[model samples]
Target: MHLELHIKSGSRSGEVIRLNEVGSQLEPSSWVKENEVIELLLRAPAKFQSATLNLYDHRVAATYVDFDENHTNFVWKPQRQKNRSLECLFINYFGLAELSVELEDEEESKVIKNFAPLEVFASKLNAQNVEDMLSYLATLGDEQLHSLFQTTKHGAGFKEGSTSPNGSLERLEHTIDKLSFLFQSLFSKPITKLLPEHRVLQASGEEDLDDSALGWLLDNLSVVEEVDDIDRAHFEFNDRMYKAHSVQVPVLKESSNLYENQVVHGFIVTLLNEADKQLTNYNRTGSLKSAFSEEMPEGYSSFFTQVNRFKKELLGNQIERCVRAIDRLKFLKHSLDKAIPVTNYILDRPILTQKAEAQQSYRGVFIEYINWFERSCPDWSVYQNLLAIKSIPTLFESYTYYRIGESLNNILNPTKKGQKPIGSLMHDIDGNEISLIREPTYWMPKNSRSNESLYINSEGKVLKSGKVKPRSSQHKYSHRCPDVVIEVRKENRPSKLIVLDAKYTYPTLAFSKYLPECTMKYVHGIHNRSNNKNLVCSMTIVHPMGDADESLQSFHSLDYSIEGSMPVSPSLQALGLQLGLSQDSDRLGETLKLLLKQAGVAIPENLQLPLFIS
Candidate 1:
């Protein structure tokens, strides 16, 4: 395929430059600047019926025209992507091939590309990102990044004891508790039922003349040998000869030793044996290890730390607890060894499954055993480590979470920190604890707040007539959800709220369409139902583009005009901050401090600050 680049803007406007193929890399006449649109024209092989262009596995639309019997021409306007090096895959009926091209914004590209670890969550994991992530994972070693990775996996911290991805292992704890209760119940009062046993005796003794015996004798009178001496007339009884008549009698026997007990006991014994095997195997093989080598991979120290800590803290703890529970269960079963008889078959019948409680408890034990058998093996440890990954997200969103935490940590003393769902507690210079809440859903309160409280979202109501009211902005018809929210709690006053959002693209492109819709909603759309008052003080859009300072001017000029009934000003304010890879890291902290100051929150400047503040 012959490819040509048509520059639509800049000094090279109206210029068409042929992209020279140098091995795998395609060289353009001049470097492509960020946000610089270029019309890519491709001449396909005559034999090829169609062609497609894909960026990082996502298909880009191309305008195609059949140029004649010789070849087909296609034009595609490729936009600026997040990464620096654009690997365009030209897919056709024949096969798949890749073309790599470089851009002018190499530094920004490098920054954005470093987020390769975030690619794991892409709808489709293609070759490009995988290669990038693997290459980057080879040089990771930053302790700070490592710490961030550890916190990001779970909002409540790694040791918070939340349910893990291993379904059966989590259920094992509950199952063990249930089994303990079951064993206790059995030991206290076992299942006892009345049974029947039969006896046959000679009819000589008077003691055997009871009603039951006589009735039995009369019922089988033909067996009497009163005159049956010819056939088998005589029988020895107590050293005396007697008639051959015999009485059959029934006796009621009560015992706890039944088939159900035996079956359950055998099942427990089997679990004990399996547990022993699992423990022995686990002991022989140590805890799950990291996939990467001891030398930290380049650009992926944080990712490595995350995966390692996850395995050690979460998976390791789970395995340890599971083994302990199994041991406890075995001990309990051992105590009942003499009480319940050893059976030839383990769970021969479905007696445990017949009862509701027993069935649930039995399921837990069986599930634990099955999960261990399939996943807890020494060889399966690698698979478990792979499954431990849970952060899965777009790089910007993930980066924004950590970025906010990092930025705040510089200016504020961290009292508490958490991730996954994302929340944190930090004290600013004033010693007041501020909360950073991310993606929290709240039910709207009936009355407007008189004291400090987070803004409540309207979680639709169900009417008395069985109809439902859709959730909206308090009393309004729409609701707005922000990416990150900072709340400053006050002593005897209402808390202040500041909203921050992470946008991967430039503000110019975003505000042109749905971006304004989102920003405007956050400013004027959010309100309290009781008073219809706006809850937000200020909202900032954090973007990755370096030129955001200029592009956001137009967005900042735009505002929503509230009507007469509204309590606040007619115009609401929305600001934009340039943030992300290659962007100034301190910008976010400074912007937040300014927002707080404007909201009348005080901060002490006497404390020693980081040297990078200038």
Candidate 2:
């Protein structure tokens, strides 16, 4: 863990923060060192925030001049000739930390390839205090701590407490980008849930009573679960924006006529008052309407009052009046009775007075806005708020894009069409966990192992067509049969199958090797008994071994293989690779990317080891 001790009160720039002392105190599983030059990743609390940083490596080596005395009893000399430009470094005593938690048998010196760069969070600003940063880091779980280390550059020396090495800098950039994106998004999402912003906007001109811009805006407020009553939505006619809302919109029913019906009347009312807004955004932005034709409709009388009764029936739904509880929605809705809340949406769009349209795509944009808002500004995590921000945001929008053109669904509109292919979840599977997920397509013919009877979907039984019933599968073979014949799509390429039946093995080679029998069992089942041709299969003994790596080595192929999670030496990459995972291009690269992102770690290049260690 690393921390920042705030020094140089006003600005961090140009402030001299020298290493005061260097030392350490070690515990069973951890240690704290002094005079260490560590780099920290930080966000300044306020504008114009800055700090002076000091660095050290050893427990008691404070002054570089002290290092000078230790080296040759010579005074430490500044490298730069100019007095002002002088920056002296104790070259002989330079140091960097290389902490390793590794295998017991391997010499710590022999483990050269470091995996992740981790940093110690030393300190930061909060409640007017310059406190210990590592103390907070201490509270974090090992995963988060591991992630912190990932943020650092492994095998690289530090200048200050939390800085990464040059080698891993690029990777660090990518990790921070992912984290920053998540943080910004999570922040925005929770913020919107905190407020009940108004939504209905007064239009300048008349459009449709149903699908018009005014109607949609008014309708939005009605179907929303917020805006409990008309009072919350509508102010006096004297107000600048004449807003009206729908009645109680049920939780899932946005298209209800009764409550939403009032929105239609509200549209006419807003249009009548704001005649300038009556024109569609198309007409408003473009020169289309003939000025002379639209002038007062040549002695037309105001029909607004006469339509009030009919509007009331539509709003009430005289056919079958239904109302939902307001208090219920308030508890869950965070607002009133609208299915989709819109106070922020209303404030966001200035289009009622501008040239924006009430297009479905535009409305969808608003829905997405709400989604983004709710995700970014989570109440629980202030560090990762995302409220309405255009900054790096995170959402499952990539899936939406993926669904646009593929075999899934033509869900996207014209504007949504894009070239970026949707990415799939790399099912880097492990353990008996695979069997836990019920197979999707293939039938899991759950039948007694004692008998070959098979059934599907609890009813439609699949029987091997014969004059008589087949004998129990267990009768011929002592082995218990799997009730399910799971199906999964093979990689769309020429492929082979290797089956390894993992088991306990105290000795080997006495029974003429489990290899041939284990290999032939599945082949015989596929060929002789089934009488089916063109089935290609290969096999290996999946017998369990004391050494997990040894078990993996026993069954190696370009095709897929499964192994139970072992007690020790479970190599993630080896398991993935040996199991025929598409690691060369897609899986390995993506795994690295995901790990880098999740770890907040980077891989820098061209950085040399620190001095003094040799």
Candidate 3:
């Protein structure tokens, strides 16, 4: 099989880049800026009359124009996709063939390809991102992106791959938008519960009371103090006077009324308030009202009108009545007669578990918010088997994670091996243990003791408990899930952290500014819950740029005073560990060794291999 990749747009438009035979390693003949259009022309061997071409790792079949009996052409545009190279595959009666092209930033002038071996494609996340980004983002159109963005940010687990133009933030905004709509729908007709309340009332007359009230009157009324004169019978009891010859008296009766003070009601109330606050913050930058309508529509007042409406409903329902009743009853050391105890919803069980439309809507809203709060990304169920544009950052993260683990395995003995996606726990000769966790979500709930990290295995499932995992000090409102985290536990010392966040961009001003802020979050945001101390000792930003600034690669301290922005890329020469394109493992290991030493971790003598050993 033979292939021809040509530049269809930009400064290099109309240039034909040659392709080598299958199995040959070659650099990208040329580069194109992100989102630039390109053309792929494929020709099958003489024996084969037709051929097939697939782009985005063959997840999306490329539509081609037949040039001849054996030749075909297809146009592809890498929309809003940047950094790292993308792989293209083709097949025919001659068998399968493969080729890759690197996509560069629009501003980058250099043409050096920071290529890693194709074996890097073995990682599932790398493959999944490519398939998901391409198929779901564009071919399915904007509505799909909007849907995916909503699905990911709401209740569904976060969809892997930062495919959207704005990445996770854009997805989150989409979720908020949907939630804003949902809250409005809910508040206009809030859910209510029929609460049975007992009230003590004095019977006025036989005709003035209902059947239940009459029954209570007949059952409770009796002579209070043995009235001597039945004609003049008037008794004083509980500081209230009652006239007799069978006169009016106080009685307790139970009546059911639709009340909005149950657990589910309070939950929705809290969600509405919090959603309004978030919408306000989101509105400061982007307008929810504008997104919703050009002008205020009927029944829609403002971005947060729903919250206010619900609050207004509370006035009519008088939730305060329940509160005052409870307070009085509790103060009097009496059993609750009219007040319903407000309690939190049980998280393990489904909220409003019933088969009604309104119940389902309430439950849906509750689950969506909880999923968002938990930071669980959407699963691949929405657009599985779809084509994905290869995400350079995700690819680099996978490369760096595996490369580091590969190097560590050389120095340390494998103590424990994880299943599914296959994580590892290694121990040095000195008994110091280091564990590699990939995309582990450290749930930093307000309760520190319950704060734990769940590992997302290769199959995208959370590893069951009892497997080794990372933990962090409690966080307020949000969870932290870094791409790659290395936990180092040395003898007689607090466990230290080495966080690797892979970025696939050059050392530009924006990149520099982002690195520190991200590093600080990883450094200080995640902490040791047991000791209440910071856990991260070194936070490295792994990029793929060969011409990175020196300052980017060098370690520096930020607010927490730990090393931050230590850029590790296969392109840069760290520790003079140069071995051509394959130097990634050595370069990463040397940097990790430096961090371990700084954190007072003792690397066993034999395990600390020399730089020349590769």
Candidate 4:
């Protein structure tokens, strides 16, 4: 397989360079200038091992790199330098299959003559799909949900079937058992007893009576030689022999309504039926569709088969339990009446109440599970559509924010003594103290000229006459909400501010020209009059590209000078930190370390490796 590189700078400036073989020298079809940012586009036969650009065997670096729509074309910017030649530029494809490269003096010829099997890449992508689903589910704040889908151990490498923990069969069995226990615990032990009722029925000798008062009489009469009893007198009442007894007849009675029990039984039956359906669907040979509408990615047939067997065994047990429970509940409901002694009812009420509470809690969890299954899992068609429309850049931004926050916590609060980590801990920029406030809201006066004059309180709401305003106009005013804000306060120094904004766009030369304008907006918005006492030390725009010289130049060229006031000095910078689909923890840590250092934050020597090790 061969790859082609297309280079484009400004309009009318473009060249095509083809790599027929590794170590093959290629000259640009057009004149290339030194220090000029050139857009290099290459379509790889396979996915690259890393999304970042690697040049001259890692000697030179490229910026703003990413894969195009099909994930075959790689896009990035390589800025030519005075002494560096673009002759040895090569991208390493460490995908499932390996590529052979031969390096010679000044020229290395490496050709990807053989392609890795497509299934290899497909399976890996499939696993990643599962990982993403697990991550989203974890955010729902349900431990049971997490346990069900979380395959990989935290900080440990991803291993197949890690989510199952106990083998799938055992896990499914445990879940069914839990459901059964929940259902059984909902009601107290059967307390039905025969009691006297106004209505009575004649008992014949042939009739078998068990717990009824009539049955008791017949049993006693059979043992007696004569029908002489203190309270009962027997006589023939019909053509056939019949026993007429004056004894009190017993009827089954209940203390509460059976409506709730009936509803619960119905829910259990539905769940069991659904489980069986899923089991059956998965049990079929070559059926890789999961309960979720998305088809299982290729190479997971065996895994699904195992899961199906587990579900099948589990469903069998659950079905039996469910059927038996339903029968018992029906019998109790039919035999009992809603009139019983309050004292007897109270005697069993505590235990039954506890059981009912437990049942309610479990029912709630199952309901939530059902809701999540219905709403969270997309059908195959919808899933494919979503894949086509999903924004990779947006997802990358979210992950970057989390990664940056985590890295900061490890570096600044290594001991974990603080109430909250640095990333999420919002502090009052003007306040001298170092306490962290979550979702800290600032109230700006309506009369204020700029959106900078803001107020912060413990409740984050405007106070009026010792009470919060029911409707405050302060909400209409705009306030700065930077992507990441870090406030550091030293003993005798003013509070320092570090504001960062995460941009998902590629930082091309044209885009870099706007960096100064963007940085100025961030600075003025965050460091307005409300934060006059604090020093706006640094402002940065973080992206998933290489550092553009234009961005740096633009940031440095920003003017904070005023006519009559001393010029304000602040460090403005842009960082290209790639946090892509493939998790590169080392790269993340390196980027964060550089970001913090550039922002004037000191990294403790002992905290270096610990930040990314886990």
Tell me the TM-score of each prediction against the true structure: 0.39, 0.19, 0.32, 0.38
Model 2 lDDT on a 0 to 1 scale? 0.23
* Candidate 2 Cα misplacement greater than 4 A, ranges: 1-258, 261-334, 337-496, 502-517, 528-534, 543-545, 552-614
Task: Report lDDT per candidate.
Answer: 0.46, 0.23, 0.41, 0.38
Instruction: State which candidate, 1 or 2, has the greater lDDT.
Output: 1
Error of 2 at 33 (Å): 45
Candidate number achieving the greatest TM-score relative to the actual structure: 1
TM-score of model number 1:
0.39
lDDT of 4 by residue, 216-299 (tens): 556556432334442343433333344443333555644333433433434444444544543443333233322321343333
Off by over 4 Å in 3: 1-389, 413-423, 447-450, 454-477, 509-511, 547-552, 555-581, 584-586, 612-614
TM-score, prediction 4? 0.38
Candidate 3 structure quality by residue, lDDT tens digits, 209-283: 456644654566662334344343344445554442233333443322223224333433434443344333322
Off by over 4 Å in 4: 1-194, 197-396, 413-423, 426-478, 489-493, 509-511, 528-531, 546-569, 581-604, 610-614
Task: Residues 401-437, candidate 1: write the lDDT tens digits.
Answer: 5566665665554332222222366566656667666
Predict model 4's lDDT versus the native: 0.38
Order the candidates by TM-score, highest first — what do you get? 1, 4, 3, 2
**Per-residue lDDT for 552 in model 2?**
28
Prediction 2 TM-score vs. true: 0.19
